[model samples]
Target: MTSVPMIDEILAEFLQSGLGIHVGTRNEQLLPAGCRATAIKVEDDGRHVVVFVPKSAAPAVFENLRTNGRIAVSMARPADDRAAQVKGLMMFSWDANPDEEALARAQWAGFLAQLDGIGLPGIATSSWRVFPCRAVRVKVTAVFNQTPGPDAGAALP
Candidate 1:
């Protein structure tokens, strides 16, 4: 099994620190969507992650996430290429709070709209709360080495 850190504690740290995750789809048939976003919001109790994406791409992105239930997310410094990307199966959970959900929808719309002007293909930037499923499974790889890195080689320590 491939693993590189998907524990709740690690995810919580990422969320609290406001990390940037490169959200991509697992849809192999099409080119992956490469959009940047911060872990803007996390559930108060730690059940979900609120990510801000281009409003325009929200529908397709959410739809893809909903249908596929798989995502590759990573956090890296603004200028650093060395980062960790973990594949976590995601699901959309409805927020009982109408205002919050509405805000999410609005953000999604705005993010999606931005993509229209840009000629390049990319995912939309709507903000949605990501309720990741249980039973986390991750795929990990280390560059420049046949052996895994210090962090990549072991289970949650």
Candidate 2:
């Protein structure tokens, strides 16, 4: 697939729609690893994104990024199953600042609200955590429609 260097308005909106984000990567041996991301931000240039994952939740995810630089981010609205997947290469990562930590808190709150609206209780999501995180930056290579349908997996133009 030809790589699109920028994200458009529609896709950008969808990506920030208070959906819970999940990130995945594979090590040199192609072993898969993944974990939930607390928050995400699309850069102004539309080609880069920063995802905040719990500082200690999944060490393997960080290792995979260092080993291969590849990442796949999947996000979906639980209510309707609308979804998208972003494929990219890791650009850099750093410990999130206090302000970024606040952003993560807000993002998780929104996610919890969404769950409540969908009739899910907060207790069921108690295991989820967000804070003291490292922001993984990715330079987008491609995006795909993952919304369960005939057009699922179709690359976004």
Candidate 3:
């Protein structure tokens, strides 16, 4: 099998920094499902991204990933609105590991802190649970610049 292309340093850092992150998947019937990811872990030199989604809020997304591998994830910086979207194929879905669980909690906290730092109210407290999560690993197949401007939505090389 051909190896996946690695995400560049800038994009990798953006993903790992707990910015405005959302992950989406479609069921076999093409019904869409999405949720805000608690954290995103870049592994294997950025060829793989594992997204942590709450079981409470997105059980349908988890089930969709199981039935169909297609996935789309978007991340943006709240400060600048710079963003990117990745479209990929899910390689695996499983329970979050111990370390992953911890990281997700930390990231989620940091995300809230960032919002507060910018004078925005954080998400509802009840929406921030870290346990009972599913980790969906995706092999990125395409990257696009979602930032507004002349090249908005253009596929990245």
Q: Pick the candidate with the highest TM-score.
A: 2
Give the Cα lDDT of each candidate. 0.43, 0.84, 0.80
lDDT of 2 by residue, 37-62 (tens): 88888887788989887887678889
Q: Could you tell me the TM-score of candidate 1?
A: 0.44
Candidate 1, poorest ten consecutive residues by summed lDDT: 137-146
Clashing residue pairs found in predicted model 3:
none
- Using lDDT as the measure, name the better of candidate 1 and candidate 3: 3
Q: lDDT tens digits, residues 3-102, model 1? A: 3333356545543353344567645466465545433344443344545444434455556666665665555432222344544556553332455545
Cα displacement (angstroms), candidate 3, residue 55, comes to 1.3
Ranking by TM-score: 2, 3, 1
RMSD of each: 9.9, 2.8, 2.3
Candidate 1's C-alpha lDDT?
A: 0.43
TM-scores, all models, native as reference = 0.44, 0.91, 0.87
Evaluate candidate 3 by giving its C-alpha RMSD to the native, one decimal: 2.3
Count backbone overlaps in model 3. Answer: 0
